[model samples]
Target: MRHAVVIIHGIGEQKPMDTLRGFVSSVTRNQGTDGKNIEFYSKPDELSNLFELRRLTTASAEDEGRVKTDFFEYYWAYNVRDTKVQQVLTWIWQILFRWPWSLPKRIRPFHIAIWFIIFASLALILSGYDIPFMGEDQPMWIGAIGTLLTAMLSYLFTGYVGDAARYTSPSPGNIAERQKIRKDGIMLLKSLHESNKYEKIILVGHSLGAIIGYDIIRNLWSEYNTKYVDGKYKDQLLKFEKDYAQPENVALNIKPYQSAQEDLLYQQNDGGNPWRITHFITLGSPLTHASFLLAKNISELKERMKERELPKSPPVFEVIKNINRFTYLPDFKKPGRVLHHSAPFACTQWINVYYENDYVGGNLSEYFGKGIREHKIKIKGSPWLRFVPFLSHTHYWSDDGNLKRCEASLAILTSIIWDKKMPEKDEKEKQTVQPDANELAGLEL
Candidate 1:
């Protein structure tokens, strides 16, 4: 099947239909395919499908109103997940591609949990006895339970509860609301699926649009596998089942990991059958650093601090260890992994586009400033450095170098689409590191 590309705009930004058309033209000018061969769609068009679910079932005025409300909530939650995923993805890319030695600001929540667990284990070893509050007699068991409970509570409190309003505010409430938005997007994609004219599908998103793209790809893959495969892809199916089998899975399934699935999606089966996606790209995404998204204003800061009761004497060392076990480990001189959003880190199949200088037009920095305020940290000269040379966040895509980088990145993506052989890495350089500019220039494209 021929490949198709879908372009989605960022929040409150102009749809990139025309700019994408130009990009396609530029790409095809030196390549084989023409611009028309690439399919382009806008975020609104894709999102509009989510709204159609309201008609799927009849309801009284109150019920219908509730449904609408629920849909918006889901929409916002989906956005939060998308943002997280983008930041995480960016962190991964920075670690792997940009600065392998330098850790990305965002650390996976799972990793954070491990860090805390290690500390908790140490605390138990040091105290020689489990603390009394855990209701366990054995020190080891007490430490383990305490660690688990504390980690769970911290995750629930910090990861979700603390951020709940942020996710739900733009659209809030229950599953019905979320389902409506998802249904809208799904319905739209279904229509596109029915067309069947395009063989390859490329998904491009910015910010929340990127999150939605992740959800669509995941749901599409799930539906396709459920309907088409008959245990042939059992291994892949098993992983998905393990990951998405619970009620919480429902939330995670629709969240940013949907984007992360792109990494696992293209893995080849024993029969050499690979899950195929034409391409995926995200621009100016904050998936790598999510602290940017939390409430940043003084009022929001005071409220969050009050809610968490920061003055509660810094979680007991034992509690701190337990909480740290699950949360992203904080680097005193550097921002925590919370900064790395998921979009860039989670992308396995597609090349991610990022800017060293601008991120969604300095919105990330502004948002991050708010988060810093909550911690009573000064924004200026803070550990999280802003190092933009000349470009602001919004203009990254328009810059000549960035545009070239995009082209180079897209070339790599195109190579993947055609199943072209990728360049082999030099074994001689196992211990040596390469510069980012050279790496970009050395792209096979």
Candidate 2:
């Protein structure tokens, strides 16, 4: 009956340990578990190494000199297991409590108001000052003044805006930083599994963490054969072997059928059992699509156009050949296709919870446009909410309706983790249970 939860946070947000705790507690209560036999392990600080690594890699040449210093700082900061756990708890508290207080520090309303006033004043001055048209007499000073004001605003705001965006953007670096983070995350998971002899472990991730979760599971499956060694999941491995059998084994062992990287991990001598990860839940993920349409679409369009323009007439063959030479070619990788966003949906072992109204990266259309366009999209319908609407990628965890959807999704996932059959409820069936008001108010640090 030993069960554990590993919660990873989304981008631009610190670890969501508190949110997870609340969600877990709420679900357990709803399910009448009463938090009796559940063990929660939140590792918010485990990613500090990742953050530092990102910082070092992203820093300019002058700052790169201190990469080693930053690395050591992270090593010392996150080296201890207990300390990492405490850091996670601390981060949970900060997110649930300190975030509101610190909001002003990040973005002061007064500063915003002042900037608004300045922009308003400039606009008024510009409106009053006129510019001359080709045949009309107008105050030409207005255009000059407006341009000057715009230039001034650009000069003052450029760096601030850039930095703000950077704060939100994931670290842009070569493969090393990503590899380090992935390695660290896997190591942390392995350590946790070793420390806690949980029969079942669930990894839950939001945004980038979702990608990390996929990598971890893929790595695990790739490394260990289907055998649970000792009390360490050797049984599950044997079960898989018995269930899938030899032909399936051949399929898994074959390359291109399974990713080469995944195959390598499967063959690796990691003692950790990949199949131990019973369930993975991803929220507001954007893994299936490229960040830019140009990366995915332009080439597709070119191919389509080329096919259409393939000379039907023999006389037009030379003309078509010349046309092909001038066709547009897109650099697919330069725009960086959104990786791991589709992992949750695409993964057989994972359950995905999407939100309605995720502004930045929530729309499946952005990533799975071809599916929608081709009318090939299908989702397992929920009785509680027949349809989960697309929401802003970042807001899914916070929105009330979406949160309920997430809860329902987690309930289903929990059932999967326990290997219990999901109780079928008709579309008309409703659980009118209200959240415990006392528990909501009773969330102390």
Candidate 3:
């Protein structure tokens, strides 16, 4: 079956295709020689790829049965730039002092350190600090002016790229902005899946992008359940969508979810939701910091814990619930595969990869509950480098010709996405898939 992967990048002033190219390089290096083993096709619109299966060779065979993989980069940093500066200023303030209060004890120090750096740098700049015998022996006031300009530029940089500023803010506008981005991402996935080009889908999100990815999956499945599984907002949504969702000149790839089981069944067996998320991969994610940067006040995590409620990490809980909602049936009409009863969860698996020293990365297993896979790789770097919060955070999946970290991380990631596992005769069975061609692709595109 064909596979599609969506890559969501974290906060940054990113150039188009920069993240995509780097990611492709990393995965390519890890897989084998670049152009020979992993060929990447850059598309005119957005997505690009050609992840070759080791066993699949000839051009026609590769296109027909091999694991054909495509990559799409979900970009939203540009949207944040258009937001009001006042909102960003408020976010800067919260990030400096208030946000740390909401962080877990383990990660609070990193947050605190980051806060100190921001304010301290600004203070030092404002104080007119100057290098010895430099800048044409500029006046102290001139230094201050230069620093002030620098500070403004820095603020703009952080505001534009620091997705956390928008994501974690309590402002309704910021929240709405984030929701819009997630909606766009979800719609993209819907089209990609409905194109009937991919059977298994995997989403890879890094840093704040992981949080965005989490929301997309969480909301996409929730919407699907409401319209397809539970059958709540069916006809109204369908009728409204026909008039509003599609543009006059454009064609809609995915149809509205139908209320009837027969409709959903037909869509599935026929071509409705042919693809499902087989795996979700997170690298250097700040998912654990969600309640702090994502909520209005003390966050739902603390509220639930204090109130003796579910005590859920909202994103993780939603992901688990959605992944477990339904299973993909490759051959629905087959005698044994047909008539499989509906189950509580879907079959999507999550693979979270983090480094011990990553300032923004934290363990998700405690929040992910049992039966979830979590991987931690030892980062080989100068001991002093770990102290640089942002550097360490971004290095997890970066491929600057450094193969160790990328190779280590991709080893586990590839295993989850491309490994082979036999189908269970029934839903009650639990099995580990082999980390080979058979596990995932079955050499089938």
lDDT string, candidate 2, 1-445, tens digits:
2445565554432322344444444333333234343333332343333443221111112221211111001121122111122333333233333223333222234345555786887997778755234235546886688789977655433322222222222334224444565576677567645654444456766665555565665554434332212222222222222222222112232222222222212222133334345456666554432222112233553343234321110001112322211111123322211112112211123445654433222333323221111111223335423343333344433333344545544555445444333222231123212334453331111
What are the runs in model 3 whose C-alpha is more than 4 Å off? 30-36, 44-66, 83-86, 95-102, 111-149, 152-162, 226-275, 296-299, 302-346, 384-387, 420-445
lDDT of each: 0.36, 0.36, 0.54
**Model 1, span 1-445: residue lDDT tens:** 2334455444431222434444444333333334323232222333332442121111212321211100111123333332333333343333333221232233333345555786899998798885555554556866788789977765554444333223323333334544554565566555555655433355665555554555565555444332222233334333332333233113332233443243233322222323344355555554333332333333553354335321111110112322221112234343222101111112233334544543331222222111110101111222233353213323323323234434434454344333323211232124222334442231111
lDDT by residue (105-128, candidate 3, tens digit) is 667786788878878989988989
Where does model 1 exceed 4 Å of error? 13-16, 33-182, 218-222, 233-278, 291-350, 360-445
Per-model TM against the reference: 0.37, 0.39, 0.64
TM-score of 1: 0.37
Rank list by TM-score: 3, 2, 1
Deviation of model 3 at 169, angstroms: 2.2
The alpha-carbon root-mean-square deviation between model 2 and the true structure, to one decimal in Å, is 20.9
